[model samples]
Target: MFDLDRWLEIFQTINKNKLRTLLAGFTVTLGILIFTVLFGMGNGLKNTFYTFFQDDAQNTIFIYPGFATKPFKGFKENRRIEFKNEDLALLEEKFGDRIEFTTARISKGTTVKYKSEYGNYTVRAVHPEHQYLEKTIIDRGRFINENDIEKDTRVATIGRLVEKDLFGNENAVGKYFTLNKIVYRVVGVFSDEGGDREERNIYTPVSTTQLIYKNTDKIDQINLSYDMAIGANGARRLSRDIKKVLKDKHNIAPSDRNGIYVESVIEDLEQNLQLANVLQIIVFWIGLGTLFAGVIGISNIMVYIVKERTKELGIRKALGAKPSTVIGMILQETMVITMIFGYIGLLIGNFVLNSMGNKLEDWFITNPNVSQGTIIFATVILILSGLIAGYIPARRAARVKPIVALRDE
Candidate 1:
């Protein structure tokens, strides 16, 4: 099906109108470049949302205590709704099957000292199961154990940044660090891939912290993990039930909206899913629009070329050239220009995105990339563009007759 003569004719025609060819090629390349990068940006935005999900389990829910904004049962407004250590235990007992892991947390910024090197870092008192709630990467030794809580032993697991600040190049594990002047043995050094900012926290057993920091039986928040079988709908129902249970226990009104602050990771994940879907649809439409613009430009150029070469086309027809031959020449030229330039644009966009890697503009954009499937899609669009641009003009070329060509000035 390959015709060398048709290809030669296309090349000769394009060479004679270099500027015209360049303009047509520019339209195709520019459209493809914009479309490709839009795809990359949409991917980057999805990654930005994923970074938050990485901080905890996909099914984790966080419960932070807040004051009652409305009163109930002879109580006035603005009553404080604080969580006690007993509240978390009671919830676990009541919803053991629905919940997989649960932990109470109390955190504050305090001075930590190791051999005269001191820094202010956020110290968190958490149960042993707290490790499962956060993306805790234990770099050395172990996290707080049940033994630490049972005996109320003073033990610490410091973040990587805290370790670097307090004991650089020296092993922190098996050593002692004083927090608020109370010496606690360092059991582990941990970090988050979210970088040094998230790695500045130090964790200890909740029981020990209550004794040392005078938190007593009070807990600031509760972290919970659940099975995926209790999906987003189940999770929402559980969240509402938990809030109602706590409100009733605290004697807050049934309608008191500010009695507690309960958040579900399931809800956040669902919202993210919706946002990503919308972004994909918008990118698809915009890319199609740009591609159409390129097709229009190529179609316009082909029509002008057919008009300009009417005399030549007529002479070829008079000399017994077939109609298919005339159509083949025009189609070959359009396809050559579109395919070559569109591929170049795709390659350049991929190069720019690949060069960016993990770090890019702000934390908003990370690892922007186009998949092989998306590239295949763009190629299919190019082939259609070639067909559309050449069709009408090639048909007109085929219809040219010797008398009409002799008449055309």
Candidate 2:
């Protein structure tokens, strides 16, 4: 029941000891403030990691040839391993069902020119699957397609940076630019989340690049993936099977680890996920530690308050006050302090984080905010704090004898 008298009595007590209540409230506020800030920062770190991996499929794998460090199948050590387009074709033919996507790539540092402007840029010959692999964003025109590769067309998809420097603000689609003294028309303007280095490359069909560079059928690397939806374990298994088959084909001994290098994007993603979980646990532990300190302080103050109010409680008990009523009164005061303090802390935290939004802009962190669940959880914790802190003190007050409490100084 809503007791007006009880409410007025509670307010009277708070009004009588304003400074003491304020000091106790400050401790709770500080604890929640630290908690809110730590979680906000944790969220930022997680955002940074996700943004870094946004450019590629979570399940993607990259294969690069490496020099033989140990002799395999009686072959001499230090022999260089190279991949050819046939390797890709063979893999596709064999694992066509399991293989979801694939790309073969070779890069070169070349001078790109458009009349009076020229700049150092990377030229990459890639298959149609390369666009999806790189998470490419096309601003204009179209990316390299199967027809371009089959016909070996003298057409290129240039990065936004390439378009910017070579052609200024002019439309780059259908314009011609010379790469290594050979003219190729720009067919698309593309960009990626991979930042400036990735933006300095020009993409073209693999067949054309192989023919123009006089390195027919040669490729530097291959990217393959099973599926992102199936997650890391499935992707790992697929990659292992693919690697075993490639090892057998390349005359690489089963024990030779240096003959072919396999880098798993799935592994990186799994590691990031584990790290994010660990970070949340650590942040909450630290925050809870700080908050619990305030809880202890509140417990101590309630103890002191009980000692001071002993005589009054004894008189009330003599006048027919119930033990539960005494307990509820003490709990109500602690709850009020916690609610006010925690709310102020929550409000301050959100205001600060929101105000700093502009300054915190970048790939590192985005849209850091405390969720409603967090606020609700904090309030729950506050209610628990009130019950816990006031329990023993309320019990002691309930046990007071009228004669003894009245006799106390």
Name the regions of candidate 2 deviating beyond 4 angstroms. Answer: 228-231, 358-366
Over 1-409, each residue of candidate 2 has an lDDT whose tens digit, in order, gives: 2789888988899899998888878888888888887777667767767777878876678998887777778788888888998899888998777768899998889999999999999998899889888888999999999999899999999999989898998999999989989999999999988988788889999999888776578899998767556666766777777778788788777777888888887688669868986987899899888888888888888898899988888888889889888888988888888788888888887887787663665645555667789878977997798679888888888788878888777
Query: Alpha-carbon error at 269 in model 2, in Å?
Result: 1.1
How well is each residue in 299-367 modelled by candidate 1, as lDDT tens digits?
898899889989888888889889998887788888999998889889888887888777765857768
The TM-score measured for candidate 2 stands at 0.93
C-alpha RMSD in Å of predicted model 1 compared with the true structure: 2.1
> Scored by CA lDDT, what does every candidate get?
0.87, 0.84
Clashing pairs in 2: none
